[model samples]
Target: MTRYRPPQPQSSPYISKPGYKALNEELKGLWKTRREVTAALSAAAAEGDRSENAEYIYRKKQLREIDRRIRYLQKRLDVLIIVDKPPTNQQQVFFGAWVELEDEEGNSVAYRIVGPDEFNVEKNWISMDSPVARALMKKSLDDEVSVQRPAGPIHYIITGIHYTED
Candidate 1:
């Protein structure tokens, strides 16, 4: 049998205050759900045959999902470096800053640069390692930036940048 070892955590580049709080809350919620599911699974098993028990199967699935999330949160928490304060200069882009971009078509998009663990496009959050964030970093408003994407290069003009606790 091969012996398995958990990998050492790597240093996290950055994380926003709100994102960190969310992760912490999520971990707590997962643990609570884990306990609830385990109890429910035991109850389902006591009811009778395990093979045909729907409650048992459902609880088992829920437990697996909770365990997966718990493991992820544990690993991520170890690596993350939280940054509560934004950069002093407001004119340039920096971690945890909300940035506005204008594409060639003149359409504008706003995104907030955040840690990888907090990256959510639908929520307007982006990772620091992302191509768009990479291009925007250290750039001031009105600066033209080009990023290399899998499809090709994409260009953007920085329209605005802001940082706030909320």
Candidate 2:
């Protein structure tokens, strides 16, 4: 049997100013970490019997992971378009907007629309390419949004929209 996987969708090239800075910092740190790991790997290799050397194996794996992230960051950084300015029309929902939504149950939720690279669930930051964000885009306060989720169509009403981090 063949294991066939569909091609993944492309991530949006937009990134917030802070997200770009964070990626740059991470890339720099990874380079420094790679140097230290390389030194450790060399030290472990010098101890002889690489097949039995746990430290050498561990360092090699660590270095590989670090390199993989560094490469991804480098490429992604090169193509990312930093979105630092707020939209001219602040009344409407757009990128980098902190949107407050209300459900039919009177439950309120706040979500910040952010770039795919910077979206964090803990921070309530949703990727702009996400279904919820896409549905919310260009919507004004009191606008109703219906997102088609796997379970069902989830509904939300835009209660507030702000451009700032708060």
Q: Rate the local accuracy (lDDT) of all candidates.
A: 0.87, 0.95
Whole-model lDDT for model 1 versus the true structure?
0.87
lDDT for 156 (candidate 1) = 93
Query: Where does candidate 1 stray beyond 4 Å?
Result: 1-13
**Local lDDT at 63 for model 1:** 87
Give each model a TM-score.
0.83, 0.95
Q: Which predicted model would earn the best TM-score?
A: 2
Model 1, residue pairs in steric clash: none
Q: State each candidate's clash count.
A: 0, 0
Across 8-96, the per-residue lDDT of candidate 2 in tens digits comes to 88899998899999989989999999999999999999999999999999999999999999989988998999999999999999999
RMSD of every prediction: 3.8, 1.2
Note the residue pairs that clash in candidate 2.
none
